[model samples]
Target chain A: MKVSDGGTVLAADVFSSRCPSRSVLDHVTSKWAVLVLAALAVEPLRFSALRRRIDGVSEKMLAQTLRTLEADGFVDRVVTPTTPPQVTYSLTDLGRGLTGHLTGLLGFIQTRLPEIEAARST
Target chain B: MKVSDGGTVLAADVFSSRCPSRSVLDHVTSKWAVLVLAALAVEPLRFSALRRRIDGVSEKMLAQTLRTLEADGFVDRVVTPTTPPQVTYSLTDLGRGLTGHLTGLLGFIQTRLPEIEAARST
Candidate 1:
């Protein structure tokens, strides 16, 4: 993780279209991805529970978003031995670190939703 | 802003497709819109400066994003009555509040670019 060159973090910038952070930004900001991250931030849940918690998310979309999150190192999927083999998904330290702000935004959105709707009407 | 009966925030969940939060989430997470918000969170910038700040955004895209942000109440367009009537774009209070997380996520992505890259290459 030491992407340091003279103490700089390799000059990664999301604003730069060519930068890798740009693509990561795309993944992180995807609507489903954000919802999944926010849900996991509250607590780890099995795939089914997560799908249920995020209303309107199809099984296919949830699986896809989870795979992307897992690839980005923001989520971890674990399987347990059981009668039906339970699978749970949770944010890794990296995911948790990033999700702090996501949850903050979500709360802000929830609080200001009425204002937002008002603005839209006008 | 009080859409509350029992102190509930009207259940405006972004996770629900039918929720107004869904459309709001779409706007917030759009690649260009996110870039615009992140760019503005830094400082108020004119159209040209914003385009420059977010590399590779076409003029049409920038205008469209700005219009959406303005309509969504996340951005304000102020016209300065100078010789040519300069226009500057900045986040509104609502935009600023939500942008806290956007900036946080941007920083996270920038710092962890190397780690994310490593994870992706595998």
Candidate 2:
């Protein structure tokens, strides 16, 4: 099966290791990536703000996740050429499109936390 | 803000490092977990068939993922005590609910693969 993109792309199968979607999914579902996307869904934040929003994330890791998301078209990074050179990050249209699933999954897990914790202990 | 669940649950904030959802999200988004959930989203599969469907997953990792998912209540395990003792895995109702988001995310990525790849290359 083919997925037309300039008539050059094929339909992606997540189960197939050869599919590019597999790798893309990897980036989207990474621990830091998930958290970063969730953080941005509420509002645009500067680099430091994003770092603070997610617990246990290191400076280097947050930077790496942002760079990857920027490249993947899910994040928009803006640089202001000010005296301090301020930088901010927000979700791109593509990122916004993908964020619905993230939010949905998050809500599902959140509301069911009690059940999940109970399941774990048993 | 409060989210009542049995009058014992609290509202969850994913950005809060202390949220239980953080750890649950980690488990749900783990590379192997993502793949396993996607694979099982189709239908129940026996252990060997599931391993074959997901490329690059070893027996050990698959076992671990299944155990975790089972513990989390997103997956149900069925044992058929045949001569060979067959064990099958299927998504529980909870798993089914979460899978809609998974499939949604996967489709978004799959359909937009071209755009994503183009973004990455630039």
Candidate 3:
């Protein structure tokens, strides 16, 4: 979607917020949103697959995160035309951009895991 | 602090946790951590300065966030040996790295504020 000169995308539908950034922060950093983004960062995955990848996320939280991300234009929910319903999720172009940023933060956190542990020991 | 060849930084002191990455994640992604990171991203500031910069943050919450960031080694708490006692905060190299990543996420959210707001309207 093309952003207008004023920075409003497609006339500002339901996804728009007065403080859009705060809303995005709420979603991106929400309880399950970060994990969901990280899980989907690898590849398009089905619901159950996502459940497996994130260490301790519950089904309900997973579903909620997906829904929130979907609404924010950071994720695409694709339903395949098959006998048993098949719904898969992947990052949108916008979503991919977000994933890159979040992953950078996650990567730093991962590498510093030991130091973080050391800091909390006392 | 230099990381050893074994990947343990400075012999893994008090900050160490069983899952250091998870611990860092908890501190970085906590309700107020992100805001604190963002506020400090621009420049080093005193305690009250940060409180004023991040709108809607309470004194108690700000203090708590600072403590958590300091514990994780992401913030440097420099106290001035003055009669009245003065403390200042800034990101460490590690903290700066994390801030860069978090800001990227925050920037994306800020620009997409309109989209997020629009999404929530329904």
Off by over 4 Å in 2: A1-9, B1-10
Could you arrange the candidates by lDDT from highest to lowest? 2, 1, 3
lDDT of 2 by residue, A1-122 (tens): 34556768667787777777888899999879988998899999999998888988999999999998998999999999999999999999989999988999898888878787777898
Candidate with top TM-score is 2
Residue B4 displacement (Å), model 2: 13
For model 3, the local distance difference test gives 0.75
In the range B1-122, model 2's lDDT, one tens digit per residue, is 24456778578867677777778888889888988898899989999999999998899999999998999989999999999899999999888887788888888888888888888898
Better of 1 and 3 by DockQ: 1
Best by DockQ: 1
Candidate of highest lDDT: 2
Please give, for residues A32-102, the per-residue lDDT of candidate 1 as tens digits.
99899999998999998998889988899889999999998999999999989999999998889889878
Regions of candidate 3 where Cα sits further than 4 Å from its true position: A1-18, B1-18, B115-122
- Which pairs, if any, clash in model 2? none
* Per-model i-RMS: 2.0, 2.0, 6.7
Candidate 2 clash figure, as a count: 0
> Across residues B11-99, which tens digit of lDDT does each residue of candidate 1 receive?
66777676777788888888799889988998999999998899989999999999999998999999999999999999999899889
